[model samples]
Target: MSNKIKEREIQIERLQNNLSPIRKIAGWTAEVLGDKIGVTKQTISNLENKKTPMNFTQYIAIRSVLDYEISNNKENEVLPKVVALLLDCDDELDEADYSKVQDVVGTVAATAAGGTSTDKLDTVFDVLIKTLPFVVPIIGTIIGTSANWSKKLFK
Candidate 1:
């Protein structure tokens, strides 16, 4: 209500948002974290702002609740639900979707340039390896160096 209180609330919200897994793992801020732990929204706010620490027992209780929920709903539930939204969206992927597939160009073009039919299909596979990072957005950077091998050989 007071200006200081409002500022703290905003800062707390930002802190929660900045957490990498707060959205992915917790399904957003102050969610089941509060409902299951018997902690109030205000208490969660204070935790996020570092005004107070999460008691060891409270952390155990809260984490157990979230872990149970996320683990039970992990792949079959969460992945499918997320995929459903992308699949059901009204906007169909345009040429932009192919952009993720762009790393294919050099390999395919090289194959074409070489004018070789022997192992020509390897281009598709090679390109797929190269394009895989861009295609798999989840851990793109992890596989980033993997693609560089192709650039070394090709270019």
Candidate 2:
């Protein structure tokens, strides 16, 4: 083969490697991704496995789909869970709830960074217990238990 052909093949392999993580993180099976990109399941698998080189149009289509899905998944899955955990919310969170959680987390992070005292940490823990009493027992159990004991319980 020509040098140009070998270089093109290398580029295709790199693209496949770079895009494979997005495909896995977005929870798309090869068949599903192929459907979105207007290709066969075997085509996606071949590209992902580096068994074949993708054409320019195929590369464009796959890139577009992966980009869209990556952004959407970050917003829809990761951000909401992080906000909900920080806020200790048992209910479904909306945009407003997310904003409130973000503000509170920012404030707490800033306070912690500013050499906040152990007393202040205690106060925050008190407030957390008051705000979500149901979490107190869970927290107590975690704090009181040994790692080996917990592992043995599960086993």
Candidate 3:
């Protein structure tokens, strides 16, 4: 093998070492991710196990698929946490407002579970629009209180 090919193989080996863990973190099985990347599950297994040398095309496709999966996972994870924090920080939500928030959360969670990234965002935005009457007040109160505190400190 040429020096360049040898270096490429080493790089592939290094990537293979971390691939399985990262894929698991993204909540994807080899078969699912392989389907998304247009590869066979056996091919994915081979790459992860370092039984087959991954070519440049496979590397690019796998990297792209993984990046997309990781991004979607981050979004799905963060959205609910943020919503929870916002709800927790607010002390004055009445029964009706709480119900609205719960509805929004349920919709967002359900969409995240099965929808594409765009679909998830669309669902979230739709829920936000529907709940804006109450949500805006909560958000405004949070922001206004923070601004007041900042002004008092500066003064």
Candidate 2 lDDT by residue in tens digits, 1-155:
97655654544443565344335434456789899988889998888677887776775576566546634654333222222233223233455653444444444444444555535633543463445444444444433232222232224
lDDT per residue, candidate 1, 77-139, as tens digits?
322222211212113324465333333433443443454442443334344644444334433
Cα shift from native, residue 35, model 1 (Å): 1.0
Candidate order, TM-score descending = 3, 2, 1
Residues 112-134 of candidate 3: C-alpha lDDT, one tens digit per residue: 44544744554564556455475
* Clashes by residue pair, model 2: none
Residue runs of model 2 more than 4 Å from their true location after superposition = 1-11, 76-155
> Which of candidates 1 and 3 reaches a greater TM-score?
3
Location of the lowest summed lDDT over 10 successive residues in candidate 3: 146-155
In candidate 1 the C-alpha lDDT for residue 6 amounts to 55
Scored by TM-score, the top model is 3
Say which prediction, candidate 2 or candidate 3, comes out ahead on lDDT.
3
Return the top candidate by lDDT.
3
TM-scores of the candidates are 0.34, 0.40, 0.42
Instruction: Estimate candidate 1's alpha-carbon lDDT, on a 0 to 1 scale.
Output: 0.40
